[model samples]
Target: MAVATAALGLAAVLPGPASADPGSEVRISRTAYGVPHILARDFDGLGRGYGYAFAQDNVCELADQVVTQRGERSRWFGPDGNDGEGVNLASDAYYTGQRRAGTVERLLAREAPLGPTPELRRMVQGYADGYNRYLRETGVAHLPDPRCKGKPWARPITALDLWSVIHDVNRVSGTRQLVPEIGDARPPGTDTATSVSRVPGPARSADFGSNGWALGRDATRGGNAMVLANPHLPWADGALRFYQVHLTIPGTLDVSGAGLYGTPLVLIGHNKDVAWTHTASDAEHGSMYALELAAGDPTSYVVDGRTERMGRRTVPVTVRGADGRLTTVERTLYTSRFGPVLSTGWTTKTAYTYRDANADNLRSMNTWLAMGRASNLDELRTAQDTSQGNPWTYTLAADTSGDTYFTDASAVPHLTDAQLERCTLPGGPAEPDALDGSTSACAWGSDPDALVPGLYGPSHQPELTRADYVANSNNGPRYTNRDAPLTGFPGTYDTGDRLGLRAELGLRMIAERRDGSDGLGAPGFTAGTLRATMFGNRVLSAETGRDDLVALCRAHPVLEATDGRATDVRRACAVLARWDTRADTDSRGAALWGTYYDHLMESRSPDETGQGRALADAVRDFAAEGLPVDTKLGTLQKWAGVPLPGCDGGKGCFNVLEASPESGTGTPTAGAFGSSFLMAVELTPDGPRARTLLTYGQSANPASPHYADQTRLFSRKRWVTERFTAAEIAADPHLEVKTLRG
Candidate 1:
């Protein structure tokens, strides 16, 4: 007992909330599930409400966020936190190494305050103060540091951290725009061109995709319109949505649903008269800058025609242990207008400039929060108008009008080709660079609201033309296209494999339900899951996957299509498809295809298909593994739990990404993150009745019964009831209660 106390007590001596202050007073009401019904008066109050709620469910993660956003990781991570010189922290190194840190930093330094009115700025700052107060008032001494040890204190919070987080949140307001650097490329005649119509750069790839839609009067049981939320994210922090809440400030606000950590408001979900869900969108919302070095060496560049020496800023990074002495490893950094120039000790010393709509996107969130309380399209559009951060947005909204509208959103930058050519720094250019921020109109000034061609008025945002509307895995800002695709690489657009298999099957199911009719109601909405499953099956049915892949079923005729046993089969099938029509993984046929792609990189000119390349790599890697491919999706795909490991236990168990196990790369055989937080909502005469199902439910803490308790319902594609009314919450049996005040 003495030894344990001594060890635990030392944590108290560590640094904690240095700027702790009393935060905004928040009132909380709890139902049976330990979920809170919070009421806050205004924005700051809401921030307090959120910070308190997040702290309750995930104090450790919340604290880590504060430290990370503030860039004060080393204080908590110790000497080994940053690179050798001791600067950043674990998340900082990994996040930045992935080439996004400078993106966040530059956005803040150069762009965050772009539209902040003094009032808005103060409100944001107040929210930060309130958050810090929560940390103080709670007297939270030590927080769990899961990434690295020796750091126990909660660190600190600041007003700018709030700004920084919101900036990042809204910057990624659009789905695909979130990581433009990594998305599936559009072939010349795809749908994206009419959307973004502006920013498109070197690297374009898509990791995976999702499917979701709304059913009107025609397909429901109760004759009410229904909206389905089936978002697919790699089960990880900021990847999946968490912390569901029902918030009401009455006249000021009354909304319900979920939001991810780090973000202040709900990124996606529903309110009273509507439900909004997002899949990836095919929009070119990100831009890369061409950076030039300062007046040094032969590569010296000229900025503003002034010989001002380029500023060399070095950023240090950290590695786990140093020489077994329990320390860190660090590196230096340099930056330019195009942003930081980075290297991973590889041959590619690539110089790139990247920008997103996320930097000053606080308004994007402001509008979302406002929509929670809005009752009509006018009010919703009002919110949409103020969504300053979302540059290329694909927004779909359903109103009481029985009308659905989808608008290609964002303040599209209008940079001229001339500007793109001249604004570039000293680097490479015979014809000049793709875009130089200063010279290119694409990179700068103009009414961002003006560039979107069709975004002018009513028809610009089209909704469910028929009473039954659908938005499957297209991730596109387009209404269903009837005409054939046009040919051309029009600037500011993404044109590729825009439509996926989901759209094919979703439209089929909708047609069957309505009998080619309109008016979809509640009954049709309730059968959403059935529709999804049927569509998935029907589409894959036509494209006879691969003969060799299907034949593997002969080996295990009566396959147990449950959990990992079945999941392995799918992985095997996915592998076989990559086999170049051969049954064997290591067949000469497979190598033929492999060598083809390899030679293309060396032999071909500019390789345009980032999507094709990524997908090809994934396939080829699986083929090299020498494994039999199976043909059942469910047979080899199952949700595996992502377990948080203890300090002394084996390395932590975490999310199961969709990757080929045979590749022996990416995640292990685990697949914990499947469909989480599935909700089917319908607007009825009585109001809104929602069926919500969560896989690995509400609590991130594994110890809670809520953890994985919802797993069964998730697999069945069923749902547990969710009621915003006080009376309903009172009825839940497992209701746990906690009082939160700050």
Candidate 2:
């Protein structure tokens, strides 16, 4: 990433003069597994150390992201290049449009409490300067990762660029989902090259799943608070990769845990008195509204007996052509008062627009930093109530006071029952009905308590304080605690009685251990026991369907396959009968049962022949890969040259390692997603005992010694003991220290 002006100073990148002082200093200590313990005097120095250390490890990825957030992907790369979100052209146009609208600029212009405080701004500036310092010292050509070495797109980044990255994450569940649609939207009959109408609405819920458990003293064997954070995110090397670090400012700040690649906050982890984690929530953060367009004028819509003209912004993207020449392509994007107009569900007679609850949410980092500084669960809840900045996740936390708390206080559209009943139109996406965009009567309500308008206040969202436990596995808050079901929230919040397979399995795991039925020889959980159970790799689908499937195969010695041929099921039935119902590495027939379950889910019907064919196909797939049908999972599924112990499909595996084909082959050689970072934290009286493991290692650069160290430990189901205190930091034999002055 090349900066257009190499001489742009750090002061220019910062918003104000209240950034890091001229002689700001920071110290970074690297413990085992190359985890950095950064000590500074204040937030600015802390962010400086963090940003410098993070760049030392992940400069390539961060630099590429700077280009991405700047809407220069089409310029630096090509128009068709994809950065895992959408095509380059669409991403460029979407962000360029936002820049033109001055959205982020207006956000920064707000007053302190609602916008960014001075401390936050200073920290952001310090981070930007720290990253730039690293870049200046190392020189772009000498960067470790050759991919971005000497690349023009890998230039020094600004604090505003970092802010854009933060905003992108806050809107991941909302506006980010409509990048292609917003970029390609056009007036009807004006463009013949439009393909936006064929685009799909937001997806990716299943891609982000997790099991978060917050256990109080009543559920703990040691009478202490325990939290288990098993977030199942993508294993691919990108923005979502969790970087473990311990940030400290003596008495002012002390926290240990992980944050995403390009940010300066610790998103999930533990402080001295509390431990917290997040699970992706099923609540809706945005709504798609149907616009009543005027006849023969797609750009004009009628609202409450009045004609309203849609807002128009023409965004031009500069693309690097195949011949290395730059050319400009322009598109006219439309918007209503509700929000940006989407190409999906748009026609000459009607159009669709979307409104995101988190569009202006800039305080999420404030909440996270507050959570890190919180001394107890009440403080945690207070931080939540005040910031209400959770983007789209449920907060499950446990404090040393033996209290467990759970809340879906994430940003959500504030729609009342009356408004829902009065403004519903059939066939909406995500929601049961598209909101009536024609009138202000259907608009989202506001509360004086809410920091943002058109969003539910923190008090209105689901929340609970329990002594036993609170757990969520990417499900609604209704069943956070099975014994005490929460209800009466609006449909937008996803209140319901039903639990998904993963949710049911997660709840059952807690109950069985609490009742001493899980063969763990205990009635309550200990940090050690919780860690063991997380890696237990129990496959619920196999336990429920394996026997029945085997019996069916036995009853029919031979069955018809999907190819209209006979498949012998006797061998499959025998193998399943003798197989252990777990997704462990050595479990025979686990792969076959996984295939059968996938077929059942897809067919959504009892197709006996299809099951037989699925089993047969599994066998054939193994044979094609030159392995036996009963081969150990460890022998087949390997990532980073280490055998991944968990199962491939979701398949009800609590310890999940979802896998995908290698170069389109049927054999899965790598984990594409699932179980990225696992942590078990216990707030013991002896100052917070915790263990964590990042499935992938610390650095994306394979040349780094830390690249696969933790990954190998994860393969063996091991963890790195967190070093939070100064003594623990000094105790590591592999400790290396460096200090920076600016």
Candidate 3:
């Protein structure tokens, strides 16, 4: 791959409208497992091929997302009244406010020095054109999926729609939660603002997160870098859908990995010389401000001792009636100097406003694009430092030079310690309502004219590099590496003092191997070692807490019997006593222990002592649900629509699998959110060798063969070989070729 110093200038030569014919220059070849290998002459052609391939697999999903982003869901498919369209009146109101805010238009116009650059602009345009072309070629009657074949929302999409989707993604984590408050600011009988008194804590939910690992030469058997990218995202919804593709612009770009729908760049993946992944970071990306409302007018607030009226905008929201007619309802939205004015419904005298780090950011794609083009770990770091577009994810990268890096690349609010101390109210800064906004002291101190104000410059963020290894399981930057701990960073960035079980497990795995006389007697990792560790079903809780639980059970074996529940409890103890600490499909005793552990964590009983009450409850619940005490873990925890044996372990386990309870049995064992996309890349002397598996398969269309192919493979702990090079792609016997054009 050739390194271009002025890589951003490559977009300047992108074919003009007359010469930029998609079908003439873009060739998409479907390799094994339905992965598209796109060969394009330039960035525009690459985008065209990407849009066509994505539409082929997820047209309906894409269409639905477009509809949601356009804020016309209610107009097209009635209010979210249990119609299965997944859009509600609140959604309509929120999206309408977003559109009326001019988020897309403003960002596009301002993104320049830090940019959705010319290259990105051309690529997005080409992608929109290609998506439209797909819709034109495959009429509604010929649509692949019958579920949304004739739906009016599945019509052609525009470039603006794509831009809006991107904007929505950036704001989803920040202001999306205030939709109801924005819609119901001045409800009848409510004259006060809502109280945002509760402070945000470290997210402990098992619903969404990721585990990323990078191994340098010192920790690897081949003296090469290795990376494991396991992002735990939703399996079904289009929200976190990750589409895999290999894009090549000859000498300009050659990168392959997974990205979400509607994005034109690969968010996580590897190029020839560098491989990278991301995990949610514990950084504050937004701030809440308490405004002192002026007397006699609720919508006017005092700033710098001057009464400033909040800007008011009425968004017309259209909702479809039961009879299919549309009715337009007007929703009043107010914005203060701080940002959107949220109706907190608090009786207190103060109003609240929220400002997000990426509120007007449109340069995230450009950053990812630059990272993809990087030739080394240093280059990747430079790309991140230059384009601070990443909103809230820590980046982990490994290069062929045997270097490993980890950084809180998320754009965080640059708040100084003095500012926080001076402006903090009685409550701590963690409390949403703690910031005193009457004066500019509590304000995010950034130049008002800057494109994205209050964001930390690259020098302010925390980063670490280790020749041995680096890993993060969504914990703060302080524990990126246990031995070489990142210290002295401000507490305002991350206040969590302890590491989660998953992070502990990841560190332990690396430390044990590094200390032991392993492969080549140097704690070196091989491809096989990494793969085994990822699939290893050892549950951390079982390993650490099982012996004590069994001892406690043996001591107080007898509980009050209710419908033979006492006998079931003894049986569960016996099963757990003889169980091996593993979460594989056929592991016995896993189900009982998993249930017991879950209840132990969730039990709110004040009368029960220690784990006894939780254990008894787990036994009683298991018996009541008609499941045997010694049921195999696989039988109780199955994936959707699959009859195969289930895997064990909950969130924080090395083999992480968090799930909801099965309807029939009250055991929380069914798979919900886990590692949907797993990619392991190893940098070699020849090039980069990769393997990946998507647990839910590639396409959302049920009729497609690729829909469940990888899911079956995932069930058996298997991975499909990632063909990166031209020769490797050509060697796939099942390859199918197509040429898409204008």
Candidate 4:
């Protein structure tokens, strides 16, 4: 996606900046977790350090992405193949389209007036180079392909390879750009509905969402700014690029945060002066305009007020053939103004108009890089005004001023609710049938309001409660309790369930102030407050008397439990009490139950159930059916699908979140996906730094000795500090060093 020149020739992709000196070096050390504490002399060196370190374990993923960028997936895996080959095929198609995408590329190329600064770009490139160096060092030898069953590796990677990888990253970033083509399988009674509401789907779709929050003392009265980032994502298929690093540019900046592969800087976390976070807007940023196919044929459609050819794009995907060699697959891509029109709808004569923030060419990363250097409130807002990245969400930042601002900064096409409704399959009265998968379907309403999606009408900006503090990663500003109801823009849009828990309880904690003061009525209530306020409500519900388990527990006060397990009795109870027993976290009960509304302290109604389902309920159910109140967590809660849960053929338990563990009664738990990556910051007159919680240990390699090693600490709410200073990084005896030349 990185254009090479005015001619718009796509740059041949490259690896991390190649080392100018063959002897130039970088070093990495393993800390408490497998998280690498990298040390390098220059920005490029640092990148190489991280790259080599990451590649040691996840080279396969890295290489796959590299293939994806060049649209070479089909070449390696073969075309028409759905498994490994399909991805390559798809990637190839997208890349091929990009090569043909003059207009699209031009639009994507628009610099967001600003983006990552030159210095930060160097840093990003530095990391990429570091990764390439790893390829050079280790990929020189053939490695086993667990998926393909071959010695898959690199003889030597070039910068072109890295560029190819970025090419894939760009494609992944725009996966939502294509629209599904509606075909002849139209179902009955489908047109009467108003707006798109779970019309029959094509089966499954992508799973991705994130949660981030910033809490201040007015909210916590704690002397620091706390940022929690939980990006909920499916684990496999190159879905996440998680890296936790503490970047110290000396006086320029200092921050402890999480980064993705390919990205140079942290996505969310706290710097010296402030902390910022984000969450998806869940707005129908992408809409579909029904196509009136010529003579009811599914393939032909109208564009620009005239019947036009729907450019046919065929993707050849490679997969493992029954005979073993990779095979080819050919898939079709048709276009409308929105982008590529897909075939998804059943028998409905329509094509969708694809749109999303991905279309925004503004410097999303550049804006963030500037964000890292922002010192005060005004500068922060200015940095944000660029509206570079994902437009369908908002980013919130808070500084020492106890000041916070929320902005929907993205170049969004102006499409009204009326316009959006028209596009819905079950669209309302005014459903407009403009079938071309192009921009004409959903026209930009305006630019001023387009770039900024959220409403800043009258009232007050969502701030750290004067009496409290609040922040979110696309978790809306509903948590900051102003006098108004939790209605900022006035509609229910849930990007993910975690945001629900965060917003609902975040407000409750802020509003539950016993004192007339603006903040929570406690002296130093951060650590315990989190345990009591957030974790407490979900685990310990007021519900009672549904079964005799409560009465039995009343008889036995303490349950002998192991420490450190988030699912242990104490931990389990705390988490359970705060969460509503509902699967849809956006439900009012989700907020109320977690908030301990009128009934949090009160006993449960006879018919009401407790917070968690499986272990707590199962054990309590057993007790009600003649078991002891003193049941053990290990004995009841078990790894349901662990393939093999028993060590010596005995059962052990595992916790589920976001969604339920079992098939029936699919209610989710807060423990599911709340805090995958959490870091707490302390930036006072004393300056800034952080403490972190990364759930599974850092490295992706399961075989490495350091793998999963940090899980023990993270599970216990413990953190290992990041040593950013050169001296500190070098001082560790665990250091392993290597060098690479460009």
Candidate 5:
């Protein structure tokens, strides 16, 4: 793999203000497997080192994110470019409107104490400068990645650009689903106020989200705390990718874990005394309001029985023309007191306005920094309380003291039950019903003694500290633990009641000993046991339902011979009946069963008739695709260009390896998304012992050896020991050292 050339002047020394530049103070050591261990004198130095190290590995990805955040994707990539779900034009329009509205600056100014502090501002500035320095020294010609080596989009970024990227990521998930609605504009009539409509929520997928587990002293072998952090995210997207790093500022800070590309702080990681991770929560972070528009003017709405004109801003979006020229497209965006007016395609008459708790909040990084600095569980809780930074996500943590904690730590809107009842549409609060916007009654934090504007304070969020164990598989706070589940919280806080298969399996694993005993007894959970369970490749569906399904298939006489397909289906049943219920790569019968399950889910058939039809459909589909009914799971779902075999456990399995049918033929399965990072941390008398495996690797540069090193390990159900201590770091034979000075 190519390393940054010496011609790039790695030792360049540029003098900045004395306070900002601590002269040759940032040192980065690349240990075995290309993980950077950064040692800095202070926060500013730390930021610069992190920025330089990360850029060395992912400059192209970082540059692409900056372009995407600036809403200039259309300008660089063309307006017709497909942005996953829609055209680049939609992304440009939405992001351009956000920038034109001065949302980031305004939010930064309004959010006091919770916003970026002077230290954070300096750190971000240092990060920007480091990134620019890399680009200046290693010109586009020296760029290792061919994807954006000489691309105009890979230009130098500024501090403001960094801030914009952060803000964009914070809200992009919720806004992406409303892109079409955001760009729609039409005239209003009397029917606009009376029409009933709802803004559709993003499709909920079991394939997404994460699995977090924290075992306390009582649940562990050595009477210590243990935690498993497995976050499921897209492996290909640069923005969502997690980079491993160990950052230290002497006595000020020392933490190790994973930070997303383009971010300055470790979003999920651990200090010597505490370890933490997050899973997407079931709480509603953003809401849509149905506005009562004026008879003639669609941009004016009725609020509190009075007419109010919607705020309008003309945003200029740059798009590349067919002739390779850049053109400016102007769009007029409308916003009501509730929030941005969104046009639901179902009806132009009713305009849905969107609002989220994290829309403009800038305290997320600071909150993470505080968490990293925490010395114990109490201090971690205090950090969460002080920043209230997380917009939406459930946080789970464990400490050296054998204390485990769980909380919906995001800033949620505090709406009383009475308010919800009065404002809720006929669809009820659980569904995506646009609340009546004519009165303040439906608006978030409208109560007389509301905690904050458009959000609930930390004191009001659901939190718990358990001495036994706590876990979540994105099923909400209701089922954090099956034995002593958190309850009594209002439905508005979390509408989900049932446990997902993954969550159920997690609880079961934690509650039982490795020897299959009922409870955590003499041989309880250790770091080894936790790691074993995390990669067990056991499918709950197969363990519980496969036998019955196979029996059902046998009982039903093989259908009349319609070609040889019927015989194949009977053979599949026999294979399934004899097969074990695990999803290891070598497991047989999984392909047949998985195909049938996918068809069953797609058909949404509940009755006996539906089951029969689904089975027949699966058989026909497999035969059409020319696949044998008894194909091995690995043969159908192996990784591309690699010998790494695939597994059968999917979506809601404890050892999740989610995949989807290949495009076009749709018989062979391709890995879609699953465990992006799998880490297990155990607090011991000596220190914290940790091991981790990134499904992909540290660098996005395909040519780099580190790009898929960890991925190969993950494919084989293996992990690399995290070199957290100085001794561990020193023992790495492949260590390379670099120093940075501003």
Candidate 6:
């Protein structure tokens, strides 16, 4: 492991914020659940404390992200290591290709207001230094966590490494998933072109999900603004996992909530005057370009009848083999004027390429910083409009002045509907997603209001401000509020009127709670009611489908599965008949419903042909696992020995918990991804009051006391009372303090 260059010493210091140079000193105060409250003089110092505390709980994951962004995964882990979507060799090639092309460096070199600001650059530098300082102090071999302790991959990182990872995260929904197709793309006669594993279509909406609601005075019980941020993300230890923190720079900036590991900003949090959260948006941030090849020349594409040779580059990636020997492999990767060439089953006559709007985007940190410092909804809107840095998420925010805001201000292409229609290739393989590359005019449209030329201006995108509320459950920006639907936006912005079941459920919950008709004793939402609404575990599908299912079960007591198995489902039917539809931990029949739904969907038949049989098979599968059909949801859906409540959002549960199936059975064994960092913030007379929870807990290390503490709380439908005020933080019984100096 390489020795860290930064020198930081940890010792006991005074409790107040520092006024010295940012790199000189900072203080980190840890409250219950290991949530860090960092105090510093400025942005750099805030990042320093943030980086140190983050490293204390998640050094291994941080190191892993740095390695991944540096295109060194194959070099350290292996060439065959799977990066969830593709093989490590391919992932390395894609990242290395971008590096060799000097893509990130060029973006970074851009002057401020478009690229990273000086403050953001300082924050990033301090974050890297603080991460390296922790490494230097702990000595990589003696690191506390066993995952990367004494591992060769646990090397200190630089600010550039952090920037690279930021670039990768900003493209989560874009070309990041096309690594295999990009890396394996070769000319028709090349040996690698035919073997490219075809990535199915555009990225699935399931890749990211969340429910964000900003409730204004009209909808809140106390006539104040309230916000509920429930992001559904993978629970695995990686870049997607959220880390809770409270960053303060005295009067300059103070915000609390959670950000993905390795980020320097409080991505979803609130200060005294404003609170904001994000939901995954389905707007197109990247687009496919179907290239027409020149006659008899696969490497040359025809643009408006002119032959243009594809730009070629050779990327060499280092791979560590089974014998611990390092070898370099060189791959010739091709690119077009649009972007990287992709091998999505392209023929000799035509090929595909993709352009990601966020490939060189480096403004998210600045945008988030501006939001944190914003005093009201107007300022927050200004932040989004000016920075244009939100990669692919809708921002939902509230202010003390009783205003609510929602916008899908993601970095979408500025292409107009007419251009999309005209540029769409006839019989294109990835239609609606792919455009004709034969004409240069089919390229991205320009908007004067856009910070970048190829993106839609803020005015052209959809946004809404309503006094009642604005809510999004991974839906388009049209129906943020039922009464005040935002329309007249370009089709590229996902202005569809139809809503998914999960999104429908989100709106229903907000409306029900607002009208006080959902039976929780509320005409308007309070912080407590907001919490209840989140974990109510209402299974919308069961509520809408269960009675009919019960009638069907009674009609067919005996059913035969397509697999030739038969079962008497009368007992299961009886249990479900009297069962509640909620997916609470103790709710019986929820597990049965989950399995039934999975099997029923897998059968692909909506009628009684395989539907009844699917139910029978679900029962049989449960019994085979020695579990009853009426087993509790928590009993089946668990992780790290903690019983997680809630069924899959696909099954229409507002409190989403998507789980994976047991081996060879439809029965769900453990949660896969959904409902990660959750927070309910209310702006009151005395600043903002909030309750938050990181469902998977703070530290990924099993030995850490905080590893499963919050997960247990989440299982019990509990939340950690957010200690935002200085006095509140000092009053915590489990509070621990540490100060670092350089």
Winner by TM-score:
6
**Which has the better lDDT: candidate 2, or candidate 3?**
2
- Model 5 segments beyond 4 Å from truth? 1-23, 84-86, 110-112, 184-199, 202-207, 346-348, 426-432, 446-451, 518-522, 557-568, 638-640, 643-651, 661-671
Question: Which pairs clash in model 5?
Answer: none
Q: Report, for all candidates in order, the number of backbone clashes.
A: 67, 6, 9, 91, 0, 0
| Residue 456 miss distance in model 6 (angstroms) | 0.6
* Segments of candidate 3 deviating more than 4 angstroms: 1-23, 81-87, 187-207, 346-348, 421-434, 447-451, 516-522, 560-568, 604-608, 643-651, 665-671
TM for candidate 2 is 0.93
Best by lDDT: 6
Candidate 4 lDDT for residue 607: 26
lDDT agreement with native, every candidate = 0.44, 0.80, 0.74, 0.44, 0.72, 0.84
**TM-score of candidate 6 against the unseen true structure:** 0.94
**Which 10-residue window of candidate 6 scores lowest in summed lDDT?**
2-11
Question: For residues 453-482, what per-residue lDDT tens digits would candidate 4 score against the true structure?
Answer: 322211222223332344443444454334
Task: Report the error of model 4 at residue 35, Å.
Answer: 3.2
lDDT of 3 by residue, 1-742 (tens): 2434233233332233423533246778899889998877677878888888888988888898888787777888787645333236656766777777776887788655565888888889888877887888898778898768887778888777888777666655566555555554552245343323334321222225788999999888779999999887766668677889999887789999998889888889999999999887777767777778887677788888998988888788888898988888776777888877665532235666777777777778878999999999889988877777786788999999999999987767767778777776563453344567788767876533333667776666788888888898877888888878888766656758688777777788777676653232445688877877787666777788888878877887865332334433577778889998777767888778777777777755423354776678778877778888787766665555442333332434766665566666534452356677789999987899898987777788888787868877766888889999878987899888887655
- Work out the TM-score per prediction: 0.66, 0.93, 0.90, 0.68, 0.90, 0.94
Q: Write the per-residue lDDT of candidate 6 for residues 1-742, one digit (tens) a residue.
A: 2212122212122443543543467889899999999987667877788888989998999999878777888899887775443378777888888877788889899987778999889998999888888998999998989989999899989888888878878888877777778887788777654355554344533358899999999998889999999999988848889999998866578899999888898999999999999998878887888888988998999998899999988889998889999999888788998888887646679888888888778988779999999999899999988888989899999999999998888898988999988887654343335688989889998789988889888888788888999999877887889998887888877746688778899999988988899998959998888999998988888898889889998998988877787779998999889888989878888989888988988988878766787898888888788887877777767777777888777789888886675753435443368889999999998899999999988998877888879889999999999999889999999999988765
